[model samples]
Target chain A: MSRLKYDDVETGATIPERTFPVRRLDLVRYAGASGDFNPIHWNERFAKSVGLPDVIAHGMFTMAEAGRLITDWTGDPGSVVDYSVRFSAPVVVPDDDQGAEITVGGKVKSKNDDGTVTVMLTARSAGAKVLAKASAVVRLA
Target chain B: MAINPDYLGREYPAPEVYEVTRGKIREFAEAIDDLNPVYLDRASAKAMGHPDVIAPPTFPVILGMAGSALAIADPDLGVDFSRVVHGDQGFHYSRPLYAGDVLSTVTRITGIKALGGNELLTLETVAEAADGEHVVTASMMLVVRGS
Candidate 1:
């Protein structure tokens, strides 16, 4: 069941904007789950030693969070057949109750004749672009 | 540290078979705060025509990154894990990965270049199902910052 209808999809239609909070604990969980235990993502000491401003969110974490725009919009997690992004900037997570906030939003870039639509995505952290040239090709009903 | 360009175009096979399980899918989804039923409920996923609970599009990162371990760990390649930062990532899916699908990936260093004293390494990982069907290909770019 394609939750997104090709006939109903309009180019330039806006997908709802959402914000996801990225905390150190979230990174820890993501590290354990994803098996990416690079210390820069969790250890503040290691992060600074390497010249990073602070412990940073895994680029994949930011990518996953931004991808929700497509999943939530299509009502199907698997609807996205293609997704890619350039890591313009790292999402640095501070050790605090309130961590970094990644705000994600997108629009229907185009509807392809191949039963899919292109979504142009934007993600920002601390008002700085985190993901550049983000886009996804999603199948429609 | 400068990377050895000789490692370019070298391919490494996945160290092990990565079995797709609902538990792993759920854990990954929950980790990303994505609780889509298609990743949690097998019945609902099957209802949607998926063989089983399907993984998120980015889930392949686990397999691809894991497969890259051997290649990235080679001292000759001169990759300093501490200095590496992700530059870009992409996934082209032949089809969604569902629970019960076993997979393995072959990782190849597609390119290595120097830009502003930083080493940019491009790795491409192609995943295949146990049945020999191509599942997806994940391409990644890593930037090794200048010391």
Candidate 2:
């Protein structure tokens, strides 16, 4: 059940911000679950050889983290009818327990006539924006 | 090698059917650290009016990518896997995927463009249920880096 109601949302209402920790182990786990075992996502040497600074988290992983924030806020994964994002920058995850943190937040951009709302999301990691033009269209009760 | 622009508009038939299971949903939820009960417990999902446990919004990518691999791995496409990187992704869903649903996908190369010596290939995957219900449309952009 969605906590958000179409009649209750304001155009600028803020969705709570969330921070997800991404570690090297998490990247490995994501690779296994998603079947995207790109060496650059796990091999630091391969990453640097490819001109990347270090091992980076999968772009899909970052997008999934952002999706978590949206789903959590609405309380229903089904409420999200559309989602999209651009891989603006890589979330470099160092081999450490601390790893990296991705902070995601969003706001209601508009309300559609069909009881749906457009949300614009912002995701940042390592003090840099990792996703650009992130947005979702969500249906509300 | 640059991706073969001639492969544009190439379409691939649906790959093997993907069975959506509660375990896969739970695994995906844990992988992303999304501890949503609706994704784990059927009772919790039922409370939300879902017929069964529902997958995370991005869960379709797991199956969608598997289907698209047929196109990405085509020897004729001339794609160098080592040089490819994800550029963009988006999904439009007709409805959320539920546990016990069997899905199949057909992927097509929609566009291929050269930008600053790098090649960008756009692929769209249309997922449908066993009964031909349109489930989701996933679009992806891959950047093949210049040597």
Output the number of the DockQ-best candidate.
1
Each prediction's TM-score versus the true structure: 0.98, 0.97
The segments of candidate 1 whose C-alpha lies over 4 angstroms from its true place after superposition are: none
lDDT (Cα atoms) of all candidates against the true structure: 0.92, 0.90
Model 2 agreement with the true structure over A1-141: per-residue lDDT tens digits: 447678888999998888989999999999998889999999999999988899999999999999987888787888999999999998999999999999999999999999999999999998899999999999999
Q: What ranges in model 2 sit over 4 Å off? A: none
Using TM-score as the measure, the top candidate is 1
Q: What is candidate 1's TM-score for chain B alone?
A: 0.97
By summed lDDT, the worst window of 10 consecutive residues in model 2 chain B runs over B60-69
**How far is each candidate from the true structure, as Cα RMSD in Å?**
1.1, 1.2
lDDT of 2 by residue, B1-147 (tens): 767888989888665888999999999999988879899999999998999999888888876676578888898888887888899999999999999999988888998999998899999988899899999998999888888
